[model samples]
Target: MSRAQNETYLLPFDNRIEINPALAGLNKNSSYQTGNQYHFVNSEQTYNLFYASWDSYSNKLKGGVALNFSQGMLSGQNISTSAIGFYYSGFPIKINNSRILLSAGTEVLAATKHWAVAFLNNVIPHDNDAPIEQGESFFRYYIFKPKFGFLWTNNSLQIGITSTVLHTRDVAFSLIEPTTTLGYTLYVSKKVDKRVRDLYSRPFEMSPELVVFYREEATIARLRLLAEYTDKTWGAFVQNDFTNHISTLGGTIGYRHNFMRFNLNAGMGIPGISDYNSFMCELSLNIIVPPFSHSKYNPWAPAKN
Candidate 1:
């Protein structure tokens, strides 16, 4: 419905889409990183509730919800600023596979409001809103992470290396800059009993990873091919979206069964389909479950020096 309503008022969370990975892998990898035999669950499992959203149609209220600091207003609109991200990565070594993780988050909003409040988790319209003057997460950019990966599963194949900082400042409304991102994953599990179910459920996996994205001047890359099914409750993945080669082709759909994990990531741009054809949707939630490596032991087990 936006024909041209440029009121110089852009703080509705800048409308969100794809969201760069929306905190990546749920805590650090999306639904696709169930690699290294599904280890690395450093704990920090929130989502009793977290909020964000924005859809469009500005004079006020189009898909409402948005929140960063929240001043008030949802449908009538008026909370002009937002940003809240708190991620946790655990597994300092309770035993099992050697793993370490530290995920961080922080945000500020304006130009309308950022992430549009992350889509109704804040409760409102439904589909992005929030921005006041965002130049891409203005003033306060956050993401300080530390990760170490290891897996040597009797030679079937499993490799790991991770580092993420995407962008950060010392704190509050901070936008220090330079940005950095590099991630990795590899998987192998082929039990495949194929009778009905339950022999470890039905295993067959092949995951390849090389995701490096850095932004200051520039750098972006991706190479992810995954297929998985790991369970405690549920974890699933199906991916085939090469970053470039004309954006190649894209596909991703995830469901983390039960406690609540859902990702409907999208990307289908073969030159914007005639003029503008886009696909990017993310509705993430992990409100609070912070403490990891499977809480006590067997985080997947791969650290025995």
Candidate 2:
């Protein structure tokens, strides 16, 4: 069965803004809600995102690292937590005309016993590899989630594909290898080069998108749709827990200017088919350098100084 990265702490980061299409619209602010999977990572648009990765997010950086932070569907079950780990790229990278993305991640979940003993015999059960502190939950989970991506960027439109494992570390545990999530994630969205902005003004461009991901083995895995609409202000339209937890609607507001990306996401839990949930605002800034966009205005243009 597909497993989820119990790092519920990063739920907050999921509400933040992003450039990777796979993660862009699925947040708390938006009407889209997802299983307890970790969908957040460091700013990919930046030139130096290497520091905010798994082992590094907690070990090398030394600074605090967060993964997710969101309130669950149950009343009185408010959730706010973060972890030191890393996920994979939810987007594709283009080179000359080719695209490449490494779909993988590794981490040890600090889960309690209830979720641990269920599949205890199979996994290594700690003690080696990395030295974790004592008293810490042995629910340390690892994942080798693989992903597939497609990218096509010309002068008119930008589109792509991204998939994340529902849970890599699942089923039978191994004596040697680490574990990860099981299910898989797929993202199909398009960004058309609309009317020229006052220089890429938020009001001038339009990027509409759709999102869906699921896994049957993983009871928590479900399919959902998300669309990013922008005319003046960007709005992320979403549907959560469509597998069985229906009625949970979500949405987010976004705005972008040149090199800066901003976002605000809100999520609510559904009763009956869902759980009692409310809203939590999320904020984030992403710095991205277009792989093909030039910076000197015109590489061949003469200077006016």
Candidate 3:
């Protein structure tokens, strides 16, 4: 069987490196994340994916750098793929006294695919386990590619675009698998809460996010509304495939304590070509390393009169 070419990242913001290289180190502090996803397409087909990513900002380099690795397997098929990538994003460039800024980045990825076949019970004759044909038992190959991305952001609005399949070994310029996102954040805080400025006081924030990806064979779009207050988060999303007319509904819950954040997400396919049994679940954890200055100052210090 051939490799599947169409896959989407469910949580775009949390899995930023997988979606856009330009998002490397875009968060307030350096972070590392690991996650696993299980997808049940049907009784016959199942998929498992695992990934880990880390990104850090460097003042000397004036940019952010990242490393990512992922593996995927198709259950019952004995097919697997492993990939590793390095990403970089420069510091944002200011736009003429406005709050807007633009950042550009790129990544290089190396991947290997392996496929093996297993004999059925009592199928192989004695001393004839080897393939009858030459070199038919297993297949393996390597792939190398480069991707580019750009992001524009202000205080409360963000837009990003990425080209995943830009260059390959055999082709000078292959199809540009494009992905884009638009986001807006709104803050709602009481008067008393706004007056009390402290390190631990965080405003209640709600964000509406939209993401669209277009491949050569398919188009996918997602609409999500998320809310965050201090250390808790919850969100819901509806995703649709324009080419295939498939839709799914999903929700996520998360908690943050100290330097770590944990999230659980689940999705179910709507009644369509397949029954309602199609489902997916993912669990992710993020560990952030705060900047050095985070612990240098004491907010409760007394003021001199």
Candidate 4:
């Protein structure tokens, strides 16, 4: 029997001059038999990421950078990987308030893996008793990957196309093939009420959104429908994703106080032919620093002059 677990998420809202940091962990285990011998393989990974982005008013131009570090351990062997990347996006042309934007990014990564060769030799019988000299304990490599994308947005509707890992160099220690293909997304959202008030004297609104994602590499598509209700101090949302004839339900709750906001989200996978018992949880915090000036043009300015 084998089991694997993974979790990933990207910030949903658009922000100018935003800074975000996150951490993730994964675990997988499997067992196999070679002839009369049986072996178990267990792997674990952890990642840390820091990202910062800035966008111009009306979202005409944007740029960002990200730094990532990851470590993986499999059967006592350890591998480490790190990357730094930058991206630029802009709406070079616009028509009647409808805009089209192009974005491109690249990342440079370095990886190293350390293996225990002598320990492996003891586990598996050798044909000859000849002494085995200790070879290189570790190997290092590098990779460069590029990404490009385009987006078109008008009012409440948006369409986007993106390509990732356009150029990827093979890593000798990698356990899985990198996904290097094109993907598409569609988003539509609508606000239910524009004139409700909350306890904090802030506008209360409810928005429902539908988003779809498709990947050419796997010929797989997923659809998500979400409804969010928010005020100045708190917000909540419920969403569901439909894929491969299965649906997953999830919800989020968030609170804002002073300059900081906190959010918590969780999801559970629904069962199909095989009983599924998978669930994920995530927590995030955001800090807002008001711009120095109120002019919409200067994001760093205070709103009131």
Per-candidate TM-score against the hidden true structure: 0.20, 0.46, 0.71, 0.53
Candidate 1, after superposition: displacement of residue 182 in Å?
31
TM for candidate 2 is 0.46
lDDT for each candidate structure: 0.30, 0.35, 0.60, 0.39
Model 3: runs farther than 4 Å from truth? 1-13, 96-139, 166-203, 242-244, 272-276, 294-305
**What's the CA error at residue 250 for candidate 2, in Å?**
3.9
Best by lDDT: 3
lDDT of 4 at 69: 27
lDDT of 4 by residue, 140-203 (tens): 4455656565666555555555555533333443654553444444444454544335533325
User: In model 1, where do residues sit more than 4 Å from their true spots?
Assistant: 1-73, 80-91, 97-100, 111-198, 203-305
The regions of model 4 sitting more than 4 angstroms off are 1-81, 109-143, 173-202, 209-247, 273-275, 288-305
Number of the top TM-score candidate: 3
